[model samples]
Target chain A: MSDTFNFFEYYTHISQEDILLSYKGPLTDVLLSEFSRDIRAKLQEDRRTGKKVFAIFMEMAQNVLYYSKEINHFGNNDKVGTLVILNTETHYKIVTGNLVFKSSIPLLIEKCEIVNSLDRDALREYKRKLRSAPSEHESKGAGIGLVQAALTSDNPLEVKIKELQGDYAFFVLGVSVEK
Target chain B: MENLEIQGESGVYFIPTVKLRADTGVCEISGESYLEDTSEFYNAITNWLEQYIREIKKPLTFNFRLTYFNTSSSRSILDVLRVLKKFQEQGGKLTVNWYYPEDDESIAEEAEDYMKDTGLAINMFSFEPEE
Candidate 1:
């Protein structure tokens, strides 16, 4: 049996939400800067919160760009991911999802839990300590991006990990900035 | 020695504007820094600072007016600060001024963190963005 995808139904569902922008494709530095410009424009109404939202967006998008398991045969052979921004009356939400190795899920969840459990001062101290340590190039920023995202949003990370076929899993990270 | 100057670009990736002068002894790095090659980008600047301290030994001033920088850039920044701290330790005159948007406390706080990390005195200056 085959399940046919319905574009119209998906569009209807998306339009019903408060999504400001959404994209599912290769996460390249070029595309990241383009999305950065778009996010800056969309968040122009509030300058202060816009900075926080923009900072969080960069961190989360770059996370997908670096760690996603799915590689796209596009410019620079970049990774693929999904990014969405939603606007609410009081906050702006940034969400990113990408495929990763299922083996990394437990570590990712542990990292999120540690970040969520920290207070503002603790998070700052953690980031400082990480920054001082020598980073391995393979770690791709050494998880400081996640800590930076938490610090900028001043909110706990909303993470969801779903096991996929074979050794792959989908990792979704969401952060909110009060406007 | 020849000076180093790079025009920062914000296209595919952000490159912080850099101007390191051996003649005037005034170096300035302004604009956002979220480069694809963070280490390669900042290493050249750090090397230049080291050379200036070795050869010039004059009163050097560094002005940082970055509005945004990522975590990797933050590490590179600490490297730069370390260089300044070294110069200060060796009896070389140095002044490091960090300028940020008057409304952005995070940038100011980041400079403060650099100060704490490097044990270098970084003067903080906040400026208003023209509307």
Candidate 2:
């Protein structure tokens, strides 16, 4: 096979997914700002739903920015990932995929379960506990981000993990906010 | 100690406005906070606060009017609250007021949650018409 890649297949994939906004690369600051503005503009039809959609979009994008294992050109440990937003008739769905270190998978799985299982009040309590708990690492999130996503979402998080290579896996999470 | 004033940047990353005045001893951080380097940006504010707590021993009033802050920035926000709580516990006069839109129940709830974590009574001021 050759080193050259195909772009036509990728376009079809995106079209099939009904992607509104799609980005595949390092989650840089510039990309975030532009995408958020466009997303806000696109979601302006309903203010209430728009707020939830925007919030969820930001949360998911940040997750990819914080956790993805893909490195950048400058040798900085920059998290790289893919983000896609889909606007359907009944809801707004955000899908994010990133490379994850094997060791963190258990914690990530547990967190998803914790958020998915809680009601609004209970999730609020969970968020409080997370904030008060001694933060494990400087690079780690407080876990409240996912809780925030859950609060804005109408459905539980749909998370899938696929083995990629040694000590790395592709982690995908889907968050849906109803319109 | 001198005052520190930072203009909130709405572009690139949602930067919050920060003003710490020695003359009035009022520190306010308003607007959204979503910085590229979260810790680096917040440490500057905390360092200033630490110096103020050490040298300029005076009553401090903190006003937080943030509409949005990412999780990373939220950690820094928690750090600030914890510092204030400690200052109060050590007999330092401290007042924290959080102003948010009345309709934004989420922000109010977050402030309440902050109150719980810090064990400090945070005064919440609301604006905007409620639905």
Give the candidate number with the greatest DockQ: 1
What TM-score against the true chain A does chain A of each candidate get? Answer: 0.93, 0.88
lDDT of 1 by residue, A1-179 (tens): 35798889989877866787799988778778988988888778777888888888998888898889999876577899999999888888999999999988888899899999999988888888989988856687757999999988889999988888899999999999887
Off by over 4 Å in 1: A1-4, A73-76
TM-score, second chain, candidate 1: 0.96
lDDT of each: 0.89, 0.82
Tens-digit lDDT track of model 2 for A26-143: 7777888899888878767666677677778888888788778887776555668989888787777889999998888999999899899988889888877776676767445647
Looking at model 1, residue B91 earns an lDDT score of 99
Off by over 4 Å in 2: A1-18, A71-79, A101-103, A165-167, B129-131
Predicted model with the maximum TM-score? 1
| B-chain TM-score of model 2 | 0.94
Docking class of 2: medium
Error of model 1, residue A55, in angstroms = 1.3
lDDT tens per residue, model 2, B37-82? 8889888888888888888869999999887787678778988988
